[model samples]
Target: MLSKLFSELKRLPRYAILLAALTALGMTAGLYRLYAGLGATTNMSKVFPWGVWISFDLTTVALSGGAFTLAALVYVFHMHDLHAATRPTVLFGLLGYSSVLVILFFDLGRWDRFWHFIVYPNINSALFEVSWCIAIYSIILIYEFSPVIVERFGNNRLLEWIKKLTIPMVIAGITLSSMHQSSLGTLFIVMSPRLHPLWHSMLLPVFFLLSSIPAGISLIIIGSIVSDMLFGHSLSQRVLEKLGWLMPWFLGLYLALKLGELLVTEELGLLFSSGKYSLLFWLELVVGVIVPMILFSIKSVRWNRWGTLTAAMLVAAGIVLNRFDATWFAILPRQGVTYSPHWLELALLVGVASGVLLVFTILSTYFPVFVETMPTRKPQEAAVEAGRAERAPALSGD
Candidate 1:
């Protein structure tokens, strides 16, 4: 029976096969690791509850900002030029956040008692805020993403219902995302005493929120490029250029605030020092912030597809590295304890990431995720546009 199943699976596309193999491997390893227990399998302890999983959780949540950010851009800010990019961005967020929730299930110590946050309340806790926001926002992502599936199935009635809730979903998603994205940083605010002097600041939440904007924008850019490359479709040139043009301003604001934090906190000397934290600080700023700034600021780089892609990759990588370093290294650089994820632990991360990619691949393949992937609009939107068209001639004539 297993041999037959493998043979049947082999008939599918190579990408699907690879993803299934990886997902199966990762889940298998994860289950075994769970059975053996975290103490026996990994480097987690009382002091380091937030380890590799937390680092990834933070990174994925921050990147998921693209969903709400792009939503706000198109719906709240009236940037219809970005409409083409919205669905794909939402899809990215849904996959990222949903995957993080799964990874986090294993990360938290009391995995079985995950529901404690819902029944037992901790109003004062930053994690409580993050937990609630993630829950609500992920639901919003699902509702927001459902229309694509609805439309694909040709369910006009269901699609109409989904459309009516679109604007509300976008609004609520932005509100919740704004809360939780910053609260992730707030989780570390209490660690000021333990956190390295370079990263320790009361304004950590502000930094977290601000950096998320550019990181989200960069994520959209990279997603666009990848969709184009893999799906044989292209986004509107004007859309990519506009997003590229907008990236530098956000990065500049984040960079300025980060520097201002250093200045006001009087940590300029720490930035110049040759410590490991100092090195990471420079790496985060120079490579992640400054390089992307220059790249996006350049007309040639921002305008070209490959150029923007390279810049976006750097931006994403920088954000991931910064979050990971801050969580593990800068959190306790002086503690004299080196913490690296066990090989199986890393395999699990890779497996989870592969699962996300595979899911995205499958969804984008079957559903109309890209602008070019499915050119039809939801029935309500089509009707609204049609109604507007009918009135446009009369209004102009009048």
Candidate 2:
């Protein structure tokens, strides 16, 4: 098992090397921040306690919802046609959640006191629930992904054991994902009066769950496109076609829900009246939501690779911006402060992102992540092709 894990790590590409270098740099900087204290490297003040780390971590993990979304379609909805997307989605989800944990570790002011959250149970705090869920869910993600490693390593015993554990692991993953995905939004709930009216609502958790579906799906689409381009293979065009159809529906629902919330809250005027916030809001809605929805809604555009990719990218960006707006801008100003990340904080952000990309590149190259079983052609067609080859040989002989 140790050798197999090592080999898997070894299969990581040069980019992963670069990622490791950056992660090391970031880790060193992070250590300095931790030891020297937040005042040395972060722009965080008591009023603006959360900054880039919290925003990025929350957004990334919520977007990682792609794993559960895909699993739901495949295992629950019986959409077996999308099974090809399953492993890759799960892999991305694992990486995303792992990155969140790293950010969480860095974000804690009392780094040494982190163990208190775990060792001393606080079942009361929503944050306590969120943290525990994130930690436990990460483990579930690993176990869920372990079978792929077992299969690749040709470990029949381990594979058998994992297979037995699969159902339980999956159940646990879904439960954890559902809980934390909502709990993340709930984290903002107590901030009530601090959050902008547009975002402040009891339904925030529901919105979070709803938004995550599209975000997750969009990430999968983006991941698929990147994997295809980098690896020199085509994913099932049929699957892409199906996902293309599905994405628009989700995007449409997201838009409708958002608009509905704005209207019901009597915050529709805020879209135009909130000045700078208004511009950010519209950009999130238009560039991220509207454009992607329009592009994806059209079958012609969805079928075109570039168009689909563009839509997916936009949707992913929109999700990120929306989360940022909610956590940083929307909430902070109401509390009479604005937050800006320091250079070191920004560098750490970049480093974590680089590490994620590096890990992905390494894993894709070494794993059977992209390989699929091709359908057999008819015997008659095969014979005809063979006959053509035979005739060419006879012609050369003549």
Candidate number of the best lDDT:
1
lDDT of 2 by residue, 23-51 (tens): 78887787788777888788888787788
Q: Per-residue lDDT for 1-398 in model 1, tens only?
A: 99987654443335555666888888887887878888877787666756788888899988878888889988999988888888788888999998898898877667899989998988889999999999999899999889889889999998887899888888889889889988988988888777887877788888888788888988988777655444544566668788889888888888898889889888899987848788998899888988988998999887798899888888888898878876886777346666777777777887898898778866765677774433244556543433333222222121
- The C-alpha local distance difference test score for the whole of candidate 2 amounts to 0.77
Give the range where candidate 2 is weakest over 10 consecutive residues by summed lDDT: 389-398
**In model 2, where do residues sit more than 4 Å from their true spots?**
1-13, 334-336, 373-398
Q: List the global CA lDDT of all models.
A: 0.79, 0.77
| TM-score of each predicted structure versus truth | 0.89, 0.86
| Model 1 spans with C-alpha error above 4 angstroms | 1-12, 333-335, 372-398
